[model samples]
Target: MTDRAFRNLDNLRASASTARVLNLLRVSHEHGRTDGWRAAPLFENSTLNRCLVIKHRLRRNEIDAFRVRRYVATKIILPIDGSDLRVGGRYIFVDQVGFDAMLEQALGIGPSHPDRKILALIDELPSLDPFLLREQLRRNGHAPDPCYFNVSEADLMRMSDFVASEITPLVDLSIGPDADLAAENPVARLTAKIMSNSAGEDMSALGQTLMLRPEEYEEGVFCWKGFLYYKWALQTITGDIGWVVDSVRRVKPRGRVDTEQHVAIDRAKEQVRRRILITCEATADMLRVYDDAFRGLTREGRPTAFRDFLRDAPILFARLGERLGAIQHIVSFWKYRMTGDRSAPGAEELLDLLADFETSLSGRERPDVLALAA
Candidate 1:
């Protein structure tokens, strides 16, 4: 293989999006040998191998789009079908208005409603260790790790159906069984078909995996899907709160409340916080870089690249909102505590939630540290 081939393979393996999408394909397809799919030359004085690589990149981008939808569903504590998410060029709309209305109905229906329980579990997700939850689900032989919290198997199946149905349109256009790759040039058509067929096979396999075999390789896939979500969350949290940390570091607390023990505890928390945030930020940045490459692969007439960007755009927005929300909550809480400022809505409620969340998991856990770094 040439140096270019080696570079392409190196880049492929290093990509989080590629790894997850490829693994999902691997799990779904019982047939077909993809032994050195990454290492093989993408182009060798010919168009054949280049087409293969292009198809692989396309598959990975499509999966990354779904990852964004999953994160939005999990983050908002609502059941979202694919129809709920729409992607246009550089724009995404999640039906928050409908989602909120549904949530209100669920709330009015009381805690006994099934949606109420699901929403509650999702709300509690930020407070719990995903590793622990995943392990628990694996031990219990559940379908999806995210459904480990008291959700019924039937409900899990329903969620799967909803997701499958919602994503059908994108899949049909992108990689469904009916998809074809053709061009006016004969050689181009042949090579494109080869890659397109492979991609279609993978998509069919994924449909089976999502609906029928979610438990197969559940742990790895579960962690991989959350890659973007955790990355954005941790980075934004650390970045937004850097000022607070700097203040603590620069000004030594004096007097009754600033004892030696208090100072040590505060420093320990900062150290742990820094370690977590730094690891998350690095990996998140790497994914973003790969995503940029994925976005550059489209032709002039087809705006699929921009659509892919739209799919993941909501994730970035959501992360920024989370960070700003935290900062706003903190500021308002302090203001209220010191001088009775009631202008910031939900500040007191958010502070309570944060306190509860912080108490549930320690930032210094080795598994969490390793997971974030991974």
Candidate 2:
């Protein structure tokens, strides 16, 4: 990613929807008003100051509603570094009615609230056609009704209703005391709907499209997923490296004559550490590219550009896996030298598998590697 792209992402992170609301509230509260708004600075650097700062006055009847929204925003909205950031199902943090009122307050009295233009853009979303609105939800794998897929008047109306009755509530769940509204909130219902729709069903092409080409506002959903996957892979590799390093230590005898064996074990451990670090750096570079690609391409709502990312991911993973597989082979060689243990966990089986695979690739028998596998 270029320096310009990093700047763009930094700008996006600064003006995230929840962050914008929080910043507005924070700036508003700075003026010696006791309206109960407070700023909770989330992250700060030389170039960025992301904050949560949206603790507003809680009405007697509004506590439950506020708690839920606060929880969802903290859990979903804040972690998403950039993008509009939406939460679904039980995670909907702010309802339209409460949000509109808050915005009115923020815009009305807060002279210093930053990024009014971005706030205006977020506000403009609601006025767009419900069809276009629903399409955004559907594109994010949020599962808007399939009936809204067409352009008929009836379908458009259905889309409108779905937007009003379904999407809006999920987008913001701060709707205060209404005797007519169910005690069972829209969050619970939306959560149930997502679970039911996803169960035992192959993802539709629409769903795949959504995953591949997430909307700018929905980039949070995919970025979080990628973050989790990246963390898990890193943790697994770390664990494997730790175990190998420790074992090498245990095998290194405390004598001067066995220096050759000790040196070999130490070298193996160091090699593993070096190789894994290089792979991790490569992975970080890939993640930067991934982040920039989604943030830049999806800004224009073009999903086709996303397919390249999908292609790049597997190629990257395959190279990492191949490197790790080679590391495993080296570990097994050192392990056998130390312990004289041929059955070194999966070492024997992995060698056999690789030997067969290489033979298939060569379309002929290679006796050297075949003998080693045996």
* TM-score of every prediction relative to native: 0.28, 0.27
Local accuracy of candidate 1 as per-residue lDDT tens digits, 202-227: 33343343342333323223332233
Clashes of each: 2, 6
Query: How much does candidate 2 score in TM-score?
Result: 0.27
- lDDT, candidate 2, 320-342, per-residue tens: 32333333333444444446544
> What RMSD does model 2 have?
25.0
Clashing pairs in 1: 42-49, 42-50
lDDT for model 2 comes to 0.34
The collision pairs in model 2 are 39-53, 94-172, 94-173, 95-172, 95-173, 95-174
